[model samples]
Target: MTLGMVALVGVGVALSARRSGREASSATRLGLAVVSVLALWLGATALLASTDVLSFRSARPSPWPLLPLSGIAALLLLGRAPLAKTLLANTPRHWPIVAQSFRIGVELIIFAWHQDGRAPNQITFEGRNFDILVGLTAPLVAWLVATNRVTPKPVLLWNVLGLAILANTVATVATSTPGPLHLDWPGAPFTAITTWPVLWLPALLVPLAVFLHVMSLRQTLTVPR
Candidate 1:
């Protein structure tokens, strides 16, 4: 895993600790803390593994399904309101929706920069530069939930866009081939310029994060109000 993953765990912990004080809902409070702990353990540790610092070569940024998976689980722990309850409930099927929102809100900006009528080296949109922005936005999303933002309606909007992005990613994943070259893109076979853990990002971290997000969302929506 990478230090970054570990860092996220710490961040999750801090967020949970803060929530515990402000959150009146037991479920939300517990979810926040638990997800924080998991993030510290699995997600952060895997990151160390991914970068070789920890030694799990196979582990990457996402580390088995922790990112969104944990995010969603954390969301559940955030407690229940009205919209939060609704959004959280269908998160299983709607998992992809959260992904789409993240892509559109956080990723579409980067896509515009790179998708300028040419294929860039990066495979997944989140894998490209400025993706650090996604890291920023997502935390804010979580923060909003923790703090009660301008209502989940906006989150729902972003969730729709996220779902769209998820579809695109799935399509891209299907089109991708692991060889000297690929079946989808007929030109270059493989290039380091584009291989900065590009495809691996979505395949590993994204699905995991998506699952977490969905789980969190479901929990947030379902907790008895």
Candidate 2:
């Protein structure tokens, strides 16, 4: 699932760059840089997880929480960078919204993890996480935008709702995990995601989701009525 999501994000960026008005060489270089950055980010986070640096269940000054928080902050800031501005100006409006369809796969993986006893029920769809709804509706919303069947205002509202859903999922996961923020649930504390492979969920996927939503909103808000 991690690899698949990573690939989907990378491919989406590459395709957008290719389809944009930029010169072919420039687009290729940008795409390669994006993929390289993603690989490096994953490698660094994986190293921290492998060395137990992120497993801070008992540590007072834990780096675990700060890692994802800082990552999310950095990604949000990146949305305002010149490169992001150029990409947003040139890329198709529907692409970012459509890309969010990957969330369906992520929700499926989380459900599987819950059934395996690796994740708490509280973070599953049967419990507090209804993030799957965003995934299910993303494609239809993208189609509406592509065909001009909906106005930018409604699409902007939908993106805001998606952000809200994402925040709820993040809160649920944080509270369920073992830490100072941990809230007791029916089953064991959610710890599997703090390790390698699954660590990418918070480090990469969630932040990427936010970046896409912000980019979509940025584009939608700029469109003339």
* Candidate closest to the true structure, highest lDDT: 2
Which residue pairs in candidate 2 collide? none
Candidate 1 per-residue C-alpha lDDT over 104-193 given as tens digits, one digit per residue, 9 for 90 to 100: 333553355345532333444544233333344555666565565536556655444444555555444333423322355553322221
Instruction: Give the candidate number with the greatest TM-score.
Output: 2
Cα deviation in Å at residue 181, candidate 2? 1.1
lDDT of 1 at 207: 49
For residues 1-225, what per-residue lDDT tens digits would candidate 2 score against the true structure?
666666766666666676767677777777777778878888999998898667766565345666678778988887788877777787889989998988998899899988988888989899999899999999999999999999999999999999999999999998888777888778888888778777888988888889889999999999999
lDDT of 1: 0.42
Model 1 CA lDDT for position 107 = 50
Q: How far is candidate 2 from the true structure (C-alpha RMSD, Å)?
A: 1.7
